[model samples]
Target: MDSQNSMRWLNVIANIGVLIGLLSVLFQMKQDQELLRVTLTNDYYTSYITADTSFAGESLPAIWEKALLDPKNLSLKEMRIMESQTFAPINRWINLYRLSEAGIVNESFWKSQVNLDAGYYLGDSYGRAYWEVSKEDWDDGFLPKELRDHIDKTLLNRKLNETLAYY
Candidate 1:
């Protein structure tokens, strides 16, 4: 009887240990998920800053201003520069849209990004003109239908000469 009691107690202790082990693993996994989210957010900001500064110390700004005022009058080289500059933001938007769709990015953050993109890309005259010419190039499998629809809806509502306010 003593041996049986001892064995029963040992089994209960073993079961408790197993339960504690499983709980530890779950806690660790949650921590790892949160860490991943933080890492991705950091990487996103780093990439954005890099893109924003890519045209610094160059003549692109003057060309950009000229294009913004009169896109049709730009030379071939100026048009190419405009296209290259536009690509950076477009690529960022596509990446953010994909991340948002994958649940890696929060909806509110994604919506804010979309709003900013709409203000710059759909509201400005040169941006709208660029989209009219370049959108067809993105009709390949790379651009998702849902994102395209979202952009088109934003474009429909924006004015051609609208500008983004800093405040």
Candidate 2:
């Protein structure tokens, strides 16, 4: 009878140990997720800074302004530069969107980012022109359908005559 009692106590202790081990693993996973979020946020800002530095040349700003104002007048080389410059931020937004969809990044943060940049990058005339030119390429199964739909909705909702005062 005493041995039966000892076995029951041992079983209870073993179950508690297993429960504690699982909780510890869950706690560690949560910490890792938080660390990943911090690292990704830092990387996003770093990439934004790097993209801005690409326009540091003296002639580039004028070219960009020209691209924004009169895209039709730009030479092929200027058009390519404008396309590359414009795509950088759009690509970052796409990645952030994917991360948000995956639950890796908070949806609120992603929404804030899109709210801040989508108007300038997708709503403005230059942005619209870029999209009109490049959107066919995006339909080749590389971009997710939901993101494409979201971009389309943003374009449809944006004011065509919207202008940035600072530019």
Candidate 3:
């Protein structure tokens, strides 16, 4: 072939090689994302199992139940137990929040989990009290914003109702 034809063929080959390289990088990125998602999901399940067993296998559940029923009557030790009970699920929430923020978890899944746990956690007066006290200990943006806003509204509503009840 002439030198001009040879140079044209080389240019086409270089473009094809660049395209192949780009496709390979895209495939690798997709694979990495899938792996990250699976890892996050597995971590979430492990956390859930730990929390489930901790609540079921020992006296922790009973203690927490009693405190939830009569939060005002708890001794210091019982209060501390309640605090730890509260932290268990909240820690899961923080992990899930991190996963969601990183795009490892989808928005719908994260919202469902948050809503489910909030129903259980916010149902108890002691849970609400613990949230109020411990919230400051968490980093400002660590928890999901919607979850924090819901708790803020719930606490405000409780305070308002209490004030009105005094009249």
Best model per lDDT = 2
By TM-score rank, best first, the candidates go: 2, 1, 3
Question: lDDT tens string, model 1, 79-104?
Answer: 77767667766676677777777677
State the C-alpha lDDT per candidate.
0.73, 0.76, 0.71
**Which 10-residue span in candidate 1 carries the lowest summed lDDT?**
158-167
- Model 3 C-alpha lDDT per residue in residues 59-140, reported as the tens digit of each score: 6767766765677888887787667667877777677767777888886676566666654655477777788777876666
> Where does model 3 exceed 4 Å of error?
55-57, 137-139, 144-147, 150-167
Alpha-carbon deviation at 103 in model 3, angstroms = 2.0
Model 3 steric clash pairs: none
The positional error of residue 25 in candidate 3, measured at the CA in angstroms, is 1.7
Q: Estimate each model's TM-score.
A: 0.79, 0.88, 0.78
Decide which is better by lDDT, 1 or 2. 2
Candidate number with the higher lDDT (1 or 3): 1
